[model samples]
Target: MLPVGAGAIGTQARTADSPVMRMLDELNHPATAAHILAERTMLHMLRGHCNSPIAGYADTTPDGRMSLFGMVFKRDGSAFVRSHAWGDPSDPATLGSRVAADLLHQGAMKLIDATRK
Candidate 1:
Protein backbone atom coordinates (compact mmCIF):
# COMPACT_ATOMS: atom_id res chain seq x y z
CA MET A 1 0.00 0.00 0.00
CA LEU A 2 1.03 3.54 -0.55
CA PRO A 3 2.05 5.81 2.29
CA VAL A 4 -0.47 8.13 3.97
CA GLY A 5 0.56 11.09 1.86
CA ALA A 6 0.96 9.36 -1.49
CA GLY A 7 -2.33 10.59 -2.97
CA ALA A 8 -1.40 14.22 -2.42
CA ILE A 9 1.26 14.76 -5.11
CA GLY A 10 -0.88 13.83 -8.08
CA THR A 11 -3.59 16.18 -6.86
CA GLN A 12 -1.05 18.96 -6.46
CA ALA A 13 0.16 18.47 -10.04
CA ARG A 14 -3.42 18.54 -11.26
CA THR A 15 -4.05 21.67 -9.21
CA ALA A 16 -1.13 23.29 -11.04
CA ASP A 17 -3.08 22.88 -14.29
CA SER A 18 -0.59 20.39 -15.62
CA PRO A 19 -1.06 18.07 -18.59
CA VAL A 20 -2.76 15.53 -16.38
CA MET A 21 -5.57 17.95 -15.68
CA ARG A 22 -5.86 18.68 -19.36
CA MET A 23 -6.13 14.98 -20.11
CA LEU A 24 -8.83 14.57 -17.48
CA ASP A 25 -10.75 17.51 -18.89
CA GLU A 26 -10.45 16.15 -22.41
CA LEU A 27 -11.84 12.89 -21.12
CA ASN A 28 -15.05 14.73 -20.13
CA HIS A 29 -15.12 13.53 -16.53
CA PRO A 30 -17.02 16.16 -14.60
CA ALA A 31 -17.46 13.97 -11.54
CA THR A 32 -13.78 13.21 -11.43
CA ALA A 33 -13.02 16.89 -11.82
CA ALA A 34 -15.34 17.86 -9.01
CA HIS A 35 -13.96 15.23 -6.69
CA ILE A 36 -10.40 16.31 -7.28
CA LEU A 37 -11.29 19.94 -6.92
CA ALA A 38 -12.81 19.35 -3.50
CA GLU A 39 -9.88 17.26 -2.33
CA ARG A 40 -7.39 19.78 -3.59
CA THR A 41 -9.32 22.57 -1.93
CA MET A 42 -8.82 20.85 1.43
CA LEU A 43 -5.12 20.50 0.75
CA HIS A 44 -4.88 24.12 -0.23
CA MET A 45 -6.79 25.32 2.82
CA LEU A 46 -4.45 23.35 5.05
CA ARG A 47 -1.38 24.80 3.33
CA GLY A 48 -0.23 21.30 2.59
CA HIS A 49 2.40 20.80 -0.07
CA CYS A 50 3.05 17.41 -1.63
CA ASN A 51 6.11 16.94 0.53
CA SER A 52 4.18 17.51 3.74
CA PRO A 53 2.96 14.60 5.78
CA ILE A 54 -0.60 15.62 5.14
CA ALA A 55 -3.28 13.63 3.40
CA GLY A 56 -6.82 14.52 2.39
CA TYR A 57 -9.68 13.01 0.48
CA ALA A 58 -13.06 14.38 -0.52
CA ASP A 59 -16.11 12.84 -2.10
CA THR A 60 -19.73 13.61 -2.86
CA THR A 61 -22.69 11.41 -2.28
CA PRO A 62 -25.32 10.94 -4.99
CA ASP A 63 -27.64 13.02 -2.84
CA GLY A 64 -25.34 16.03 -3.13
CA ARG A 65 -23.46 16.01 0.15
CA MET A 66 -19.71 16.48 0.13
CA SER A 67 -17.52 14.90 2.77
CA LEU A 68 -13.86 15.53 3.39
CA PHE A 69 -11.30 13.67 5.45
CA GLY A 70 -7.90 15.11 6.33
CA MET A 71 -4.94 14.01 8.38
CA VAL A 72 -1.65 15.54 9.47
CA PHE A 73 1.25 13.69 11.02
CA LYS A 74 4.68 14.21 12.50
CA ARG A 75 7.70 13.10 10.53
CA ASP A 76 8.29 10.19 12.82
CA GLY A 77 4.67 9.10 12.45
CA SER A 78 4.38 9.19 16.21
CA ALA A 79 1.38 11.47 16.26
CA PHE A 80 -1.38 12.68 13.97
CA VAL A 81 -4.67 14.51 13.87
CA ARG A 82 -7.55 13.68 11.59
CA SER A 83 -10.85 15.35 11.00
CA HIS A 84 -13.86 15.20 8.71
CA ALA A 85 -16.59 17.54 7.61
CA TRP A 86 -19.67 17.44 5.41
CA GLY A 87 -21.71 19.96 3.52
CA ASP A 88 -23.48 20.66 0.26
CA PRO A 89 -21.73 19.06 -2.65
CA SER A 90 -22.16 22.14 -4.79
CA ASP A 91 -20.06 24.11 -2.32
CA PRO A 92 -17.16 21.74 -2.03
CA ALA A 93 -14.79 24.41 -0.84
CA THR A 94 -16.85 25.04 2.24
CA LEU A 95 -16.78 21.39 3.16
CA GLY A 96 -13.06 21.21 2.57
CA SER A 97 -12.37 24.36 4.54
CA ARG A 98 -14.44 23.18 7.43
CA VAL A 99 -12.55 19.92 7.60
CA ALA A 100 -9.25 21.74 7.49
CA ALA A 101 -10.43 24.01 10.26
CA ASP A 102 -11.33 21.02 12.34
CA LEU A 103 -7.90 19.57 11.81
CA LEU A 104 -6.32 22.83 12.83
CA HIS A 105 -8.45 22.95 15.97
CA GLN A 106 -7.18 19.50 16.79
CA GLY A 107 -3.58 20.78 16.56
CA ALA A 108 -2.76 19.47 13.13
CA MET A 109 -0.38 22.29 12.45
CA LYS A 110 1.86 21.14 15.26
CA LEU A 111 2.16 17.75 13.67
CA ILE A 112 2.76 19.31 10.28
CA ASP A 113 5.46 21.50 11.74
CA ALA A 114 7.12 18.50 13.27
CA THR A 115 7.25 16.85 9.87
CA ARG A 116 8.80 19.80 8.08
CA LYS A 117 12.11 19.45 9.88
Candidate 2:
Protein backbone atom coordinates (compact mmCIF):
# COMPACT_ATOMS: atom_id res chain seq x y z
CA MET A 1 0.00 0.00 0.00
CA LEU A 2 1.06 3.61 -0.33
CA PRO A 3 2.48 5.16 2.78
CA VAL A 4 -0.07 6.39 5.31
CA GLY A 5 -1.20 9.95 4.73
CA ALA A 6 -3.32 12.67 6.24
CA GLY A 7 -7.00 13.19 5.38
CA ALA A 8 -10.04 15.25 6.28
CA ILE A 9 -13.82 14.79 6.31
CA GLY A 10 -16.14 17.76 6.36
CA THR A 11 -19.71 18.91 5.93
CA GLN A 12 -20.85 21.78 3.75
CA ALA A 13 -23.44 24.50 4.22
CA ARG A 14 -24.96 27.25 2.18
CA THR A 15 -23.16 30.56 2.48
CA ALA A 16 -26.36 32.56 2.08
CA ASP A 17 -28.01 33.96 5.14
CA SER A 18 -30.18 31.39 6.91
CA PRO A 19 -31.06 30.28 10.40
CA VAL A 20 -29.42 26.91 9.99
CA MET A 21 -26.24 28.44 8.69
CA ARG A 22 -26.15 30.85 11.58
CA MET A 23 -26.71 28.03 14.04
CA LEU A 24 -23.99 25.93 12.48
CA ASP A 25 -21.62 28.83 12.56
CA GLU A 26 -22.39 29.47 16.17
CA LEU A 27 -21.75 25.85 17.04
CA ASN A 28 -18.53 25.60 15.10
CA HIS A 29 -15.23 25.55 16.91
CA PRO A 30 -12.83 28.22 15.73
CA ALA A 31 -9.78 26.00 15.34
CA THR A 32 -11.70 23.27 13.56
CA ALA A 33 -13.22 25.80 11.18
CA ALA A 34 -9.80 27.21 10.38
CA HIS A 35 -8.42 23.75 9.67
CA ILE A 36 -11.30 22.88 7.33
CA LEU A 37 -11.09 26.19 5.52
CA ALA A 38 -7.40 25.80 4.90
CA GLU A 39 -7.67 22.25 3.63
CA ARG A 40 -10.63 22.99 1.37
CA THR A 41 -9.00 26.13 0.06
CA MET A 42 -5.93 24.18 -0.97
CA LEU A 43 -7.99 21.52 -2.68
CA HIS A 44 -10.04 24.14 -4.52
CA MET A 45 -6.87 25.91 -5.67
CA LEU A 46 -5.47 22.63 -6.97
CA ARG A 47 -8.78 21.74 -8.64
CA GLY A 48 -8.76 18.43 -6.81
CA HIS A 49 -11.74 16.14 -7.04
CA CYS A 50 -12.88 13.18 -4.99
CA ASN A 51 -11.10 10.71 -7.29
CA SER A 52 -7.93 12.73 -7.66
CA PRO A 53 -4.62 11.54 -6.25
CA ILE A 54 -4.50 14.50 -3.92
CA ALA A 55 -4.35 14.87 -0.17
CA GLY A 56 -4.51 17.87 2.09
CA TYR A 57 -4.74 18.42 5.81
CA ALA A 58 -4.63 21.38 8.16
CA ASP A 59 -4.33 21.71 11.89
CA THR A 60 -3.72 24.24 14.59
CA THR A 61 -0.41 24.56 16.42
CA PRO A 62 -0.02 25.02 20.14
CA ASP A 63 0.70 28.67 19.63
CA GLY A 64 -2.57 29.14 17.63
CA ARG A 65 -1.01 29.18 14.17
CA MET A 66 -2.43 27.07 11.35
CA SER A 67 -0.32 24.42 9.65
CA LEU A 68 -1.19 23.02 6.26
CA PHE A 69 0.13 20.00 4.38
CA GLY A 70 -0.75 19.09 0.82
CA MET A 71 0.31 16.40 -1.65
CA VAL A 72 -0.34 15.34 -5.22
CA PHE A 73 0.75 11.99 -6.56
CA LYS A 74 1.17 10.03 -9.76
CA ARG A 75 -1.40 7.32 -10.49
CA ASP A 76 1.03 4.53 -9.76
CA GLY A 77 2.54 6.26 -6.77
CA SER A 78 5.81 6.49 -8.64
CA ALA A 79 6.22 10.17 -7.92
CA PHE A 80 4.63 13.03 -5.98
CA VAL A 81 5.00 16.57 -4.77
CA ARG A 82 4.18 17.95 -1.35
CA SER A 83 4.18 21.27 0.47
CA HIS A 84 3.80 22.35 4.06
CA ALA A 85 3.51 25.73 5.69
CA TRP A 86 2.46 27.63 8.78
CA GLY A 87 0.37 30.76 8.82
CA ASP A 88 -2.00 32.80 10.88
CA PRO A 89 -5.23 31.05 11.77
CA SER A 90 -7.15 34.18 10.87
CA ASP A 91 -6.17 33.88 7.20
CA PRO A 92 -6.00 30.18 6.46
CA ALA A 93 -6.80 30.67 2.78
CA THR A 94 -3.58 32.56 2.24
CA LEU A 95 -1.63 29.68 3.73
CA GLY A 96 -3.43 27.21 1.52
CA SER A 97 -2.79 29.28 -1.56
CA ARG A 98 0.88 29.57 -0.68
CA VAL A 99 1.28 25.81 -0.39
CA ALA A 100 -0.63 25.22 -3.61
CA ALA A 101 1.73 27.64 -5.35
CA ASP A 102 4.70 25.76 -3.97
CA LEU A 103 3.42 22.43 -5.18
CA LEU A 104 2.65 23.86 -8.61
CA HIS A 105 6.18 25.27 -8.75
CA GLN A 106 7.44 21.75 -8.04
CA GLY A 107 5.59 20.43 -11.11
CA ALA A 108 2.67 18.90 -9.28
CA MET A 109 0.41 19.54 -12.28
CA LYS A 110 2.42 17.21 -14.48
CA LEU A 111 1.92 14.39 -12.04
CA ILE A 112 -1.73 15.28 -11.58
CA ASP A 113 -2.42 15.46 -15.30
CA ALA A 114 -0.78 12.11 -15.97
CA THR A 115 -3.38 10.52 -13.75
CA ARG A 116 -6.11 11.59 -16.17
CA LYS A 117 -4.82 9.36 -18.95
Candidate 3:
Protein backbone atom coordinates (compact mmCIF):
# COMPACT_ATOMS: atom_id res chain seq x y z
CA MET A 1 0.00 0.00 0.00
CA LEU A 2 1.09 3.57 -0.61
CA PRO A 3 2.29 5.26 2.59
CA VAL A 4 0.69 8.51 3.75
CA GLY A 5 3.85 10.63 3.87
CA ALA A 6 6.00 9.67 0.94
CA GLY A 7 8.30 12.60 1.64
CA ALA A 8 8.35 12.04 5.37
CA ILE A 9 10.21 8.75 5.05
CA GLY A 10 13.52 9.96 3.72
CA THR A 11 13.83 12.53 6.49
CA GLN A 12 16.02 10.01 8.24
CA ALA A 13 17.71 8.82 5.10
CA ARG A 14 20.85 10.75 5.91
CA THR A 15 21.36 8.97 9.22
CA ALA A 16 24.21 6.48 9.17
CA ASP A 17 21.94 4.05 11.01
CA SER A 18 18.17 3.91 11.36
CA PRO A 19 16.65 5.12 14.62
CA VAL A 20 13.89 2.53 14.38
CA MET A 21 16.47 -0.16 13.91
CA ARG A 22 18.41 1.18 16.89
CA MET A 23 15.25 1.10 19.00
CA LEU A 24 14.38 -2.38 17.87
CA ASP A 25 17.89 -3.53 18.67
CA GLU A 26 17.13 -2.72 22.28
CA LEU A 27 14.06 -4.96 22.15
CA ASN A 28 13.66 -8.70 22.16
CA HIS A 29 13.64 -8.83 18.38
CA PRO A 30 16.58 -6.83 17.12
CA ALA A 31 16.39 -8.27 13.65
CA THR A 32 12.76 -7.39 13.36
CA ALA A 33 13.43 -3.85 14.44
CA ALA A 34 16.24 -3.62 11.96
CA HIS A 35 13.93 -4.66 9.16
CA ILE A 36 11.48 -1.94 10.07
CA LEU A 37 14.33 0.52 10.26
CA ALA A 38 15.44 -0.50 6.81
CA GLU A 39 12.03 0.35 5.46
CA ARG A 40 12.20 4.14 5.77
CA THR A 41 8.79 4.27 4.17
CA MET A 42 7.24 2.49 7.13
CA LEU A 43 9.27 4.45 9.65
CA HIS A 44 8.09 7.74 8.20
CA MET A 45 4.53 6.49 8.62
CA LEU A 46 5.00 5.81 12.35
CA ARG A 47 4.91 9.14 14.16
CA GLY A 48 3.62 7.81 17.47
CA HIS A 49 5.71 8.24 20.63
CA CYS A 50 4.13 5.64 22.89
CA ASN A 51 6.41 2.85 23.97
CA SER A 52 4.86 -0.49 24.96
CA PRO A 53 4.98 -4.14 24.09
CA ILE A 54 2.52 -5.20 21.40
CA ALA A 55 1.26 -8.80 20.95
CA GLY A 56 1.62 -10.41 17.57
CA TYR A 57 2.56 -13.35 15.33
CA ALA A 58 3.57 -13.92 11.73
CA ASP A 59 1.32 -15.85 9.37
CA THR A 60 3.07 -18.06 6.87
CA THR A 61 1.67 -18.94 3.49
CA PRO A 62 1.84 -22.45 2.07
CA ASP A 63 4.55 -21.25 -0.24
CA GLY A 64 6.58 -19.97 2.75
CA ARG A 65 5.70 -16.31 2.68
CA MET A 66 5.14 -14.37 5.89
CA SER A 67 2.96 -11.33 6.52
CA LEU A 68 3.36 -9.17 9.60
CA PHE A 69 0.41 -7.47 11.25
CA GLY A 70 0.07 -5.10 14.19
CA MET A 71 -0.76 -1.61 15.45
CA VAL A 72 1.20 1.40 16.76
CA PHE A 73 0.40 3.82 19.57
CA LYS A 74 0.95 7.52 20.11
CA ARG A 75 1.74 9.27 23.38
CA ASP A 76 -1.87 10.43 23.69
CA GLY A 77 -2.91 6.75 23.48
CA SER A 78 -3.96 6.80 19.88
CA ALA A 79 -2.96 3.99 17.53
CA PHE A 80 -2.78 3.19 13.83
CA VAL A 81 -2.30 -0.07 11.95
CA ARG A 82 1.19 -1.33 11.08
CA SER A 83 2.04 -4.12 8.67
CA HIS A 84 5.01 -5.52 6.70
CA ALA A 85 6.31 -8.26 4.47
CA TRP A 86 8.17 -11.19 6.05
CA GLY A 87 9.64 -12.57 2.92
CA ASP A 88 9.26 -16.26 1.82
CA PRO A 89 5.84 -17.38 3.04
CA SER A 90 7.07 -20.65 4.59
CA ASP A 91 10.39 -19.62 6.04
CA PRO A 92 10.57 -19.47 9.81
CA ALA A 93 13.54 -17.12 9.79
CA THR A 94 11.58 -14.57 7.79
CA LEU A 95 8.87 -14.74 10.45
CA GLY A 96 11.01 -13.30 13.24
CA SER A 97 10.66 -9.59 12.45
CA ARG A 98 7.03 -9.94 11.37
CA VAL A 99 6.22 -11.64 14.66
CA ALA A 100 7.91 -8.89 16.64
CA ALA A 101 6.01 -6.17 14.80
CA ASP A 102 2.76 -8.04 15.47
CA LEU A 103 3.45 -8.30 19.19
CA LEU A 104 4.47 -4.67 19.55
CA HIS A 105 1.67 -3.30 17.40
CA GLN A 106 -1.06 -5.32 19.16
CA GLY A 107 0.03 -4.25 22.62
CA ALA A 108 0.10 -0.62 21.54
CA MET A 109 -3.34 -0.99 19.96
CA LYS A 110 -4.84 -2.32 23.19
CA LEU A 111 -3.52 0.65 25.15
CA ILE A 112 -4.94 3.09 22.64
CA ASP A 113 -8.25 1.23 22.57
CA ALA A 114 -8.52 1.17 26.36
CA THR A 115 -8.02 4.91 26.77
CA ARG A 116 -10.55 5.69 24.07
CA LYS A 117 -13.22 3.57 25.76
Highest lDDT against the true fold, candidate: 2
lDDT (10s digit) by residue, model 3, range 1-117: 322222222223335668865754455443343334433323333322233323233444566455544444443545444555556533444444454455445564455445444
Collision count of model 2: 0
Better model by TM-score, 2 or 3?
Answer: 2
TM-score of each: 0.72, 0.79, 0.29
- Model 2, 32-110: lDDT tens digits are 7777778778777777765678887787889988888888898888888999999999998899899989988998888
lDDT of 1 by residue, 54-100 (tens): 87776676777776777888777888888877787677767778888
Angstrom error of the Cα, residue 43, model 1: value is: 1.2
Off by over 4 Å in 1: 1-26
**Alpha-carbon deviation at 31 in model 1, angstroms:** 2.1
Per-residue error at 81 for model 2, in Å? 0.7
Error of 1 at 115 (Å): 2.1
Residue 5, candidate 3: C-alpha displacement in angstroms: 31
The model with the greater lDDT, 1 or 3, is: 1
